[model samples]
Target: MKLVTYRHNGKTSIGKVEADRIIDLPRNDPALPDTMLALLQGGQDTMARARAVRGDYSVPLSEVQLLAPLPNPSKFLAIGMNYRKHVEEAARVGVQTPPTQVWFNKQVSCINGPFGDVHLPAVSDKLDYEVELCAVIGQRCRRVSREDAASVVAGYMVCNDVSVRDWQLATQTMTVGKSFDTCGPTGPWIVTPDELGDPHALRLRMWVNGELRQDDETGSMIHDIYAQIEHLSTAFTLEPGDLLATGTPSGVGVAMSPATYLRAGDVMRAEIDGIGAIENRVVAEPV
Candidate 1:
């Protein structure tokens, strides 16, 4: 089942997506709560209750505003150059692929919903887009084993990890380049892990203004999702609402022969199989 957080009547509420319409989850359900994260924190039982929800409180597809699947996560970690092709592309630019997983943090303020506009920040001119498979944690755990890591995942969503190449390269760390407000665009809806088994086998693709840029399968990932979780959990607790970007494939603008970068008025669309797509326009901010 596809789950979503939406705004209607100027208020945000949790809903389930069914047949292109949103089946609004009733606030007064005896079992499940109203908020998306709360429902997730309630674990599998709440999911069962949400699945049993059946009603036509659903609104038309075009009627309401869809918000980020998890509005504010406790932590947002990203794996860098985990795709083989992306690593190869990075090698061309002198950024070597790591033997272990390369991880970084994205400020929560960077998060934005699907169909939002991403600002080309005045501080940098080399904005780039990365299409990646991202997952949200369902349960809290520290030092989780690889075998138990996948079970802790609540759901998956498509994320565009917008980067400022210049800012990223100067510091040798991606946090600054990756944390611009509105840089991260995620969600049309979140697909529960049960519905999207084998996260590593999905196809991830990205387009810049209708031109296909990155097109590779998650099977190409150097360090797959479970490994990433185990690796990260060893260092920090994976809390409920924690988000992880599983990394991107090759075909980014910076790796192109001519080296293209996004400018004001450009658009980007990213999609992953099972999880839907997210599209965002580029607009200039005042310098």
Candidate 2:
């Protein structure tokens, strides 16, 4: 089932998306948690309950505004240069490949709705797009082995690790550039593991306007999701709702020979096979 956070008829709630409608969980059972994080922390039993939801409390998906599925995650993390071609492209831009997983914080404050507009920061003209596969942690645990990593992940979502390149490169910590308001766009809905199957085998893509830009398979990741989970958990506990952006592939605007960054009015779309897509138009940040 696709888990979603949606707003309809002036109320927001965690919902189950099916066909062309969204099943309102809170309306069906007030016992259900009201937020995605609460639902996830409720663990398997809560998930089972959400799946068994059956009622007249559903609305056409078109009538609801979809928000970031896990809008208030404890943390939103991303792995950098985890794709070989992406690593190669980074090297071209003078960013070196790491000997170990290069992890960064996208700051939870940056979180944006699946279809929300992305801001072109007034401070920089180097805005860029990176379409990535995001894993949402379901449990609070540390030092997880790669073998057990799959069990801890709640589900997956498509994420756009929008970057303000100049600010990102101005410092070793990319958080500033990556965490600009509206920089992190994720959702549509969360596809639970059972529904998504093998995440690494899916094809992902990015487009500007209607032209294809970044296209690659999750299989191209140099460090798979399990490895990322194992590595990240080794450093700290990964709590329910924490997001792990697996990394983008090679065709980012920065890697193009002439460096074609996003401008105001540009539209960006990111999607993964089996999962759905999210499209956001770029608008300039207001003073």
Candidate 3:
């Protein structure tokens, strides 16, 4: 089932997307949590309840505005150079591939709707895009084994890990460059794990202003989702609603010959097969 957080009639609610209509869970059952994060915290029981919900309270997709499926996740983490080609591309620019998984944080405040506007920050001009397949963690667990990692995942979504190259390179920790407000665009909605089998097999593509700049398969990743969860969980607890971006494949603007960067009016369309697509327009930061 496709779960979504949507705004309709001046109010925000969580629901399930079926065809072009939304089954308003909160309206259908007052006992269900009103927010995605809360519902996720409810675990398998909540998901079962969500699946069982069937009622007349529904709205057409066009009538409601779709928000980030898990708008307020506990943590928004990302992997860097997990894709072999992306690692090779980094090598051309003097970045050495790490021996182990490289992780970074994209502050939760950076989260934006799948169709929201991405502002071209006034502070820098090296803004770039990284189309990544995001994994949504379902349960709270620590030290999860690689074999059991799949059980911890709730579903998947398309994420654009919008970056500021200058700030990123200026610091050892990439948080500053990665955390710019409105930089992280995710959702279209989250597809349950059962619905999206084998996350690594999905084809990922990103287009900037109608030009296909990034195209690759998730299978190209050196360290897949299961291993990533195993690595991260070893260090900390993986909580429900925590988003883990599985890293982007090669073909980022920074890796281009002329080093093309995002400017106002550029539209980025990031898509992953099965999960869905998210399109965000780049606009100049309001003065």
TM-score each candidate. Answer: 0.96, 0.99, 0.99
In candidate 2, which residue pairs clash? Answer: none
Give lDDT: candidate 3, residue 140: 98
Model 2 quality (TM-score): 0.99
Model 1, 54-76: lDDT tens digits are 86467876889998888788788
* Residue 156 error, candidate 1, Å: 0.5
The weakest ten consecutive residues by lDDT in model 2 span: 55-64
Query: Given candidate 3, what's the lDDT at residue 203?
Result: 98
Residue 53, candidate 1: Cα error in Å is 1.3
Question: Candidate 2 on 69-173: residue-level lDDT in tens?
Answer: 999999999989999899998899888889999888998999999999999988899999999999999989899999999999999999999999989888988
Cα lDDT tens digits, model 3, 140-243, are 99999999999999999999999999998899889999999999999999999999988989999999999999999999999999999999999999899999
Indicate the worst ten consecutive residues by lDDT in candidate 1: 26-35
Question: Model 1: clashing residue pairs?
Answer: none
**C-alpha lDDT of candidate 2 relative to the true structure:** 0.94
- lDDT, model 3: 0.94
